[model samples]
Target: MATTTNDTTYTESELEAEKTAGSRSALAMARRGAFYLSLGLAAAMTVLFLPDLLALLVMGWTAEAGAELGIHRLHVMGIAAVVGAFLLGLFVQAYKPRERIASMWGAFLVILTASVGTVWFGVGRPEEVLPFLAVTGIALVAHPAGRRLLRRGNSYSPALLGLVAVAAIPILAFAATQLSMSSSTVDPHALDGHYVMMTALLIAPIAYGLFAALGFDGWRLASWFAALPIAYYGLLSIAFPAQVGSTGAMWGVAAICWAIAFVAVAEYSRTETSSMLRREVGHSS
Candidate 1:
């Protein structure tokens, strides 16, 4: 009776172990399948939209020609179509969270198409037009998607910070030019000092975020340092709008700073989550 009982107990243990292994194998397969599906959807959406995008460009050209002949109607339908695709993808992804990346990629492609359409419709130096389109397109597409991707524990901090810097540089350069022009006649000292200070404040978060993303503890500490100056200036502007000269420009700078800070925080959170997971694994082992 004892021998028989031992055999039965061993058989049950083996079955349970086999079941656990099968479950793990099934889960891994599901993860791989999800990844492939997302990639395929992204690619298929890009291909399907290409022809419509081309048609939009052609329509934009027609509209531009018509405007020259005193017939003024905007070829905004193409723009609407492109925007609609993005909206549709967004909604679909909202309902199906697993497909978020695929949807974001789809929306990005639509934005790229619309940017091309804009260049085709607008009467400007193609060189000038393309750069503007590319910059704006990249910023608008990247910010929200980058935010989402980073939130998913993905290591997009470096790229996200780079995008913010790219978006900010042009604005900072334009602000500097405007400040220079205004300073030529007005008391240049006060304005110049404020401009320099604000520019540094704006760039500080970006630098810190980049450093943190690159795995530097000091960079993480520096982000807190950067935030204080930004907050101080932000409050000062609110209190003394006249002193700031351009509330709009200051607000824009503040927004960029906040974006940088948010990215830093998200990256830190990801690091902590990884650390916790590692600790749990060590304990289990």
Candidate 2:
């Protein structure tokens, strides 16, 4: 009778331990979900602000907003960029960060700094000071939430979801741009420059999706290529500032795409590279 009682007790203890471990894992996953969601929110906001609706409202396809409005638009993009970066930091730092994550941060910081800085300097206004502060404050809140998600393991579901989002936006953007361009009259002379940039934006996401989903070294290289469209499109707005601004009020949407692509690709690259290296090492061992 004592032996049977001890056996039952052992069984219960093992079950209890398993339950505790499961609960901990569930909590970790929940935290990771929240962290990724925050990043998605930041990306969405940046997309909304990209086209400079107010500037487009008054400026009307001039590719440049009137002086005051232009500065205001630039301020919005700057704020979006900061928020995007902060959210990205939270996501990247959440996983088991390593050399790859460091590289990811370095690359993104440089890109965001250079790109967003231009907008900050190019069209900055004193009136936007308060707004910038407010946006920064929001990002500060998101930072901690993301930090809480940090864990020692990795999960592909989050990466997969983020990648899906990264791919879907551009695909939609491509359709929207095409539709807009079809109905709107772009100057014949300017068509050449516009087509080149738009074509890249159209093709990039498809390529990003293809290689990212295919997995392997291809996945590791996805972000580097994913960045191509954003880098291409973002600059075109500045380069042909007159052109994008003139096209429509939706220019800000492209900027949002830029932010999403940047972070998505950076994170994807880091994770994929780490996974590949570990596999390679395991095989070699």
| C-alpha TM-scores of all predictions | 0.32, 0.31
Question: Model 2, residue 36: displacement in angstroms?
Answer: 3.5
The TM-score of candidate 1 is 0.32
Looking at candidate 1, the ten consecutive residues that score lowest on lDDT are 69-78
Q: State the TM-score for model 2.
A: 0.31
Candidate 2 deviant stretches above 4 angstroms: 1-16, 47-221, 224-285
Model 1 has an lDDT value of 0.41
Candidate 2 lDDT: 0.40
Task: Give a tens-digit lDDT track for model 2, residues 91-139.
Answer: 3533443322322332233333333332333322223322333343343
The Cα error of candidate 2 at residue 8, in Å, is 5.1
lDDT of 1 by residue, 112-171 (tens): 443443343332134432443343343334333334543322233444354446645754
RMSD of each: 17.3, 14.4
